[model samples]
Target chain A: MQSDNPTAAILVIGDEILSGRTREGNAHHLAQVLNATGFDLREIRVVSDDQDQIVAAVRALDGSLGGAFDLLFTSGGIGPTHDDITADAVAAAHGTTVVVDAGARALLQARCDRMGLELTPNRLRMARIPVGATLIDNAVSAAPGFSIGQTHVMAGVPEVFRGMVDWLIPKLPGGRPVQSLSVEVRRGESDVAEPLAELAREFSDLSLGSYPFHDERGWGTNLVVRGLDAARVAEAMHAVKQRLAL
Target chain B: MQSDNPTAAILVIGDEILSGRTREGNAHHLAQVLNATGFDLREIRVVSDDQDQIVAAVRALDGSLGGAFDLLFTSGGIGPTHDDITADAVAAAHGTTVVVDAGARALLQARCDRMGLELTPNRLRMARIPVGATLIDNAVSAAPGFSIGQTHVMAGVPEVFRGMVDWLIPKLPGGRPVQSLSVEVRRGESDVAEPLAELAREFSDLSLGSYPFHDERGWGTNLVVRGLDAARVAEAMHAVKQRLAL
Candidate 1:
């Protein structure tokens, strides 16, 4: 199912997330957006803001570890605070240096001027971009994200991350969009496991997933079939309904 | 900061999460539980329900990839459906085989009898356990999670996962519980970055993190101090507030 589609991964760098001080939202949002845009999101990893960890994750997700991804979207650690070390870590991973980009600095200066705030040295830290990287526009905040190699570094704040993703996704290459069909049945997953397995074997090219839900009424399963081919996905959905006798 | 605490990682195995069909809650719940239990939650990885991916993540989180962890907790992929291949994957990662444990089968049988459902082969799939693994009790559901070596695998359902965690945390060895103090200031993170960095440098032993938030009112920053020593954490918080004039 993934062989034909371009694969992507997410690297969420934040101690607040790891400490459970903040609930991770950017990864989930990216997952949905990538899925809709025809990218297969293979993995999502959350690591602390530690430089070594961030660098290792960047390399690992960028294909130095094992399986490689076509794109790696990183969230968090792109702010002005001392803990925002994503730019430097990404630069180290790509064997480059962090430098202040003229465009980014101008944008920060303009934002500060508009807000009636000083463009202090601390705020200037947000202008640091990885060498040889293209600036990713952030409409919400002036401090722009950047893309060095296949990795796209974004801010940790949800609004800024969404804005960056919106600005970045349209520029990247996409694959055939996948169509999904879901059938909800109020039955235990075990009761339908055999038939679902048979259907999965029959439709090997499609991704078949069984998600169980429990509510006050009873147990139920949401069987979903996803494929790049719309006709095949529909055919598989019909077969699933028939096989499950729903 | 991590040297004194037992480091733990979470491996979430579910295509639903990666495909954006479901929001990931187990990892966040486990993160808070592990944090409160004094285990340093180092990393969290979300992978699809593919067997190879699950095996790779289990090994990676268990220290075969790069950095090793003291504990690894896995969520999802232990259901009766065909996609539930976590037991087999974990066994393969450990170079073992999945076998139906007698105790687990009995538990499944009792649950089936109570629900007045047939214990078919598909239903019996839930009894499969990794070799040499001890069953982790699941009070919400009949099927039990299991622990092999340092890896403890649990359910994906939030209620079941929480129950299993409640039953499992007390059994694991814990380190000094971390104390965290937060000082919220109605200022942008960049406005306080300099003082925060100074405070962080002064309290090098403690972990200081600045999290920026944006709401309808305006921007605000939460400066958090976390350390094993409660007094040190409090002192760092005080210095952070004083230096920032919060």
Candidate 2:
């Protein structure tokens, strides 16, 4: 499904993530990537690594707000474990089974064989895919996350999970091709809002932003202009900079 | 305000975060922290550096699911800029004018003056607090985050925000003291579920968890037993380890 908003939502699971034991952080990076790609991030939910809860959250994200969003991402719970029931839950939500896909299974099996570890039945569960979904390749790890329809599944390990997201987003069909330029203006955003807003209005396509930072020189706001068109981005930045006289 | 199923939510603001340009990731870390503390993290949101959206998200999280959560955390937007509106929104949610707390102003002024910044009127905005809230100390950064009743506010930077979480959690009246023990058993979770469930039932107070990891040795599941009582946690882990023949 598609919408004018071009929005996305994230579902994060695992008791480790919720319990403070493991500091699992991937949603922020995902949201950042999606935002840069021009996808509006609408909702983010962190559920315990329960099959029913994962299924319910997937359904909810796809129900109404999900319809409003162009993409849905599920992070963590794709590993081979007793608790890792995300694949099963995804299948259950779509009324399918967690079966081994020939491609993912072959790749994982070869990986296991390379290391001389016998592929136990449970280990093979990592090969399971929701029926008819495309596999998202994890270059860092042999166990691949999958994308069945709009839902992009990925691992919980921050490093590996990021590889899957970087792989999946660029391959997708839609995004507003991000454009941005920043200038260091030695003033608070308040000192520059009037002219910046005028420039933002003038360049309707660009999404302008301001960020403050404290460097050795002192505090300054970095004004940025983003859009699909590069020349328009440059033009807006120039106008805003001229207005600030920085 | 305490219960068996504790719930928590977070609101992250800042255009730097929404834009992919800055890998803003503190919010995801906060979600994991709240979860580790046994709060069911219901929602995690990142709004642009815009005030209306910040106000709206804070109000919604404060009122959503029939106020299902015990706390709402807001990070960012408490800086010295027109763009930093988190303090205002928190104040707005409470229908109070955000005033520069005398202590807060004095503290921030001292820090800024020491750093050689002019302490402009805009810079003083960071000192604004919703009336009648206790300030959360920031060990890493002097500008403090605050807690107004159940709503705990924090900074956007990971180091400072995490420090604020540490300061805030220990101060809140104790919930059930969480305890945990784990052992890596060389098998998938499903392969171990039947016996694990029996163990879980035997130790009714403990929350059993299994995490699967792919090491060079092969697939191994980490079995963890958690509970309020340390003795119960030990008992459950002992049973689970014995069942796994570890």
Candidate 3:
């Protein structure tokens, strides 16, 4: 039987990241948070803002990943601007139509009225949501993100995106947090690989990785041992140190 | 006739990044450098260190995109460790065999000699290169990266990766560098969406994007205009401001 923990994928939609105009802002944050909350972060994809590309990417992540992940988080392209087409693309991917959801519209209307700004037709675009979806609150900005089925769409701006994630992550089910430890070996990674592979086979329950790093001191390998059980992770790291003579 | 500038994609091969243990280190650096040097970065994908995933990613980017890009740069998995499977995956993707290249072995030997370390078999793992590929020098660390066809492989370490990029970028053919300008509008993106869309249509040749931000002052959108022609870019920005009455 599968564990109760859910898997997740992050789809970053933006031309800025592709053009090197902006460094990634939201995905990393989400990754760290998801790990701490016990959800598995499976994949991250960065695509341009083109509609077809966005729709295709959504379907590929949602459909072809073989239901491996329980939730999909998308950042960027949900704004009111022309380039912000994430909402429509998600709708298209799910074979649904986007409409102005009452909750989203009410949230936007309250925010606009409080700011003494008229809710122009263009501004109202932010209220549009795919039918049969729930609004994800945006504390930083009034424009709410929405979750249609398993896909969640949010703003690209870091602060707003973080807010939405904070608001939504707790509602989802999660497994036990993964425990990990690292052992720094003086020997280079290749020198350790042969034995490391043996250790990996012995510690089948633990996920082991050898990270080769070259710092000012010299090149060395950091052996990382991770598992859902704290005791198993500690035992694996202890065995790694003993086998590698660390 | 098509512009002379080349297009590129960055493949980040690592499990740490996908697992949120480490943030990305090199892709942003490459993106900025590529843009300044006139190459267009079309996409970036972060996949696990699994060989199948690495090979599939390489093929997908190099093959499926209709040769949409001219160069493929990969980082990580070139170390002497068991998880360092990038070199073999790259070779597999190209249907080539990985053999110990004499030049790469010499480079590693010299560095090992200088450092007074034994050239163990594990250490020599770094010398294995795809047949018929040219080695990319790693000034910081002696283990060099390699290039086969249009695919360029480099170390995952930040310093070595940047050094390899600096050495290789100059030799590749490049088009005119793109010019860009930013205009901060004191209005919400939705409020500016209509006119902005019109301005974008008018400046079809230029790539324009509206980025919404929320700071202490309030929510506003930064309009970015970019193009190869400097004069056209300025003209487009001028018309943008004029049309928006900013």
lDDT of 3 by residue, A163-201 (tens): 999999898877888788987777667678888888888
Cα lDDT of model 2 by residue, B1-246, tens digit: 123755677777766754556654575677555545656565566666656766666766664323436678888877654456788777776667777888888887787788786666765677889998789996766678887756788987566778888888766653554667888778745467668767766776667877766567755677887776777678777777788778
What docking grade does candidate 1 earn? high
lDDT, each prediction: 0.89, 0.71, 0.83
Deviating ranges (above 4 Å) for candidate 3: A1-5, A64-69, A183-195, A218-221, A244-246, B1-4, B64-68, B244-246
Worst 10 residues of 1 chain A by lDDT: A62-71
Candidate 1 per-residue lDDT, tens place, B171-197, comes to: 999987878999889989988888888
Q: Which candidate comes out best when scored by DockQ?
A: 1
Candidate 2's displacement at residue B18, Å, is 3.8
- Residue-by-residue lDDT tens digits, candidate 2, A1-246: 112447677888877766656554577788778766767776666777767767766876764334435678888888765567889888877667878998988887898799787676666888899887889996677788987767788988776788898888888765674667888888645466567657766776667767766556654677877777788788888888678886
Ranking by lDDT: 1, 3, 2
Q: What is the DockQ of each candidate?
A: 0.85, 0.31, 0.65
* DockQ, cand. 1: 0.85
Task: Encode model 1's per-residue lDDT on A7-125: one tens digit a residue.
Answer: 99999999888888888899999998998888999999999988999988888888533436888999999898888899999999999999999999999999989989899998899
Best by lDDT: 1
Ranking by TM-score: 1, 3, 2
Show where candidate 1 strays beyond 4 Å.
A64-67, B63-67
